[model samples]
Target: MLVLNSGSSSVKYQLLDMADGRRLAGGLAERIGESGGGGRIVHTSGDGGRRERTLPFPDHAAALGAVGEELRADGLGLDSPGLAAVGHRVVHGGTRFTEPTLVTDEVLEEVRALTPLAPLHNPANVTGIETARALRPDLPQVAVFDTAFHATLPEAAARYAVDRAVADRFSVRRYGFHGTSHQYVSRAAAGLLGREPSEVNVIVLHLGNGASASAVAGGVCVETSMGMTPLEGLVMGTRSGDLDPAVVFHLSRVGGLTMDEVDDLLNRRSGLVGLCGDNDMREIVRRREEGDREAAVAFDVYVHRLRKYIGAYTAVLGRVDALVFTAGVGENSAPVRAAATAGLEGLGITVDPELNAGRGGGARLVSPPGARVPVAVVPTDEEFEIARQAFALVGRSPR
Candidate 1:
């Protein structure tokens, strides 16, 4: 199976041998169609061989074609018979799509219509699906939505307390993002606890450049951090996680900022970078260690927001079985894991400092010997999850 995550300027792909869940090859095609764009593509094979090329490419089709050629060079072309289907990482599906869907004309049109819900994501997803379908007309393509997993959110959690008629007219409601990561992490947490997904309640914190938290009860997402967009959650690398709506109006009315300017401020110029001069957690940690007051405050704010959500989700779940951290920052930042759970001993949540500081690549407990709640670090594999979903869907298709 081929899992493709298409961004506005780049396409990230991974080819996997689902039979044994081993990665066959993967690469990225980036910098497509920008000014003086020298399209760059990097390919890595299963045995660790890598290749790269930089050249001018006009659009997604050209970039993808070159990527196919690179795959052909490794005898794993898109046309290979072994390739069953292509799975796409579509960022949003609204309330329409609730599962991995087989792409079709109607499906594509519906996804295109949903661009308003995910202006920065769904368009690229549509383009990727169209391009892949055109390239391999006979092959089946699946769209695995990032929002599909959160479709199960209860009305109380999903609805905004606003004028009902006006809210309905504008489709103004909470639709969480980072759902794929949340879903995978929650399930992996259950597995780490040696229990069925339906037997455990979990809170998954996906800390990366973009961060979000979710409360999963029996493998179903009941609550999530991001709402209506990916910008309303924990403090992220650049995006302001949660803020008063009045801030936007304040900036526009008093600060003489346009709506676009307000959007840019919240989505681009804020968060850790706004609080401090840096967005990278490692650098912020280094600065804090070196007695930088600004960095120390920023780190505290980030961790505080996380702890707040952890507590909120704990309430939502009612009986928390495990607290799991995933993604780039959550998996590697020992300080974050330790600090986020600190002082939560009253809630039966405590991270063993020595265990939290210990390093390993797999999911394991950082809680002390048989603590009340087990804290774990489970690396997320969204690509593999997409592949599994895509492969399962294809297997059930008519022969």
Candidate 2:
């Protein structure tokens, strides 16, 4: 199966041998719409052979065409008879799609209709899907939505406190993002605890450039940080996660800023960058170590918001058997893990300094021995999850 995660300006693809869940090939095409320069694809084969090309990729179609050509060189082209299906990581599926579905014209139209809900993501996904269909019309294409795993959220947790008539008309409600990562990490965490998913409750914090937290009770998402969009979650690299809705009105009426300007401010100019003039957590940590006051404050705010969600989700889940962290910052930042779990001993959330500070690979425990709740750093595998779901949906049993 070929898993494609198409973003606005990039397409990340992986060809997997679903029989053994091994990646056969993978590549990335970045700066898709750029001109003059900044367009490239880095393709790596299963045996670690690498090839990079710098060329003009004016759109997703062009980029994907190049990807096909590269894959052909590796004997894993889209037209290969061994290719089963194409799994797309669609960022939003609204409430209509609850599981991986075989893509069709109607499905494409429905995904297009959802553009307003995911203005920056769904269109790119549709483009990838359309391009793949054109490339191999006879092949099965599956859409594994990032929102699908959270569809299990009950009404009370999904609803927003507002006028039902107005809210329904505007489709205003919580539709958490990063469902793929949360689902994968939660299940992985359960496995790390030597328990089945149904026997464990986990709090998964996917702290990447865009961050979100999920409270999973018995393999089902009870509550998540992101709502309606990816913007209503933990503080991100450039996005202001949670803010007063009235701030939008205030910016327009009092601050003399247009809605678009305010939107850009919140979405592009806020978070760690707005707080400390730098978005990268590593740089922020480095500056903090140098006694930079702004960096220190930004780190504090970031960790404060993370800790709040950790505490909140702990309450929500009642008994969190595992507190799992994943994604770039969650998996790599030792300071972040330490700061986020600091002083939470009463809740059985304590990270051993020696283990937390040590650097290693894959999911491993960082909590003290026999701690009430184990803290672990589980790397998320959304691409593999997408491929697994897609292959399963096509009635193929993975070896």
Best by lDDT: 2
Across 310-398, the per-residue lDDT of candidate 1 in tens digits comes to 99999999999999999999999999999999899989999998999999989989999889988999999999889888899998432
Worst 10 residues of 2 by lDDT: 30-39
In model 1, the Cα lDDT at residue 120 comes to 90
How accurate locally, in lDDT, is each candidate? 0.92, 0.94
Worst 10 residues of 1 by lDDT: 390-399
TM-score versus the correct structure, for each prediction = 0.98, 0.98
Over 1-399, each residue of candidate 2 has an lDDT whose tens digit, in order, gives 999999988999999998798889999999999878678999999999999999988998899999999999988887899999999999889899989999999999999999999999999999999999998999999999999999999999999999999989888889999998999999999999999999999999999999999999999999999999888979999999999999999899999998889989999999999999999999999999999999999999999999999999988888989999999999999999999999899999999999999888988999999999999999999999999899999999788
Query: In model 2, where do residues sit more than 4 Å from their true spots?
Result: none
Clashes of each: 0, 1
Estimate candidate 2's RMSD in Å. Answer: 1.1
Off by over 4 Å in 1: 396-399
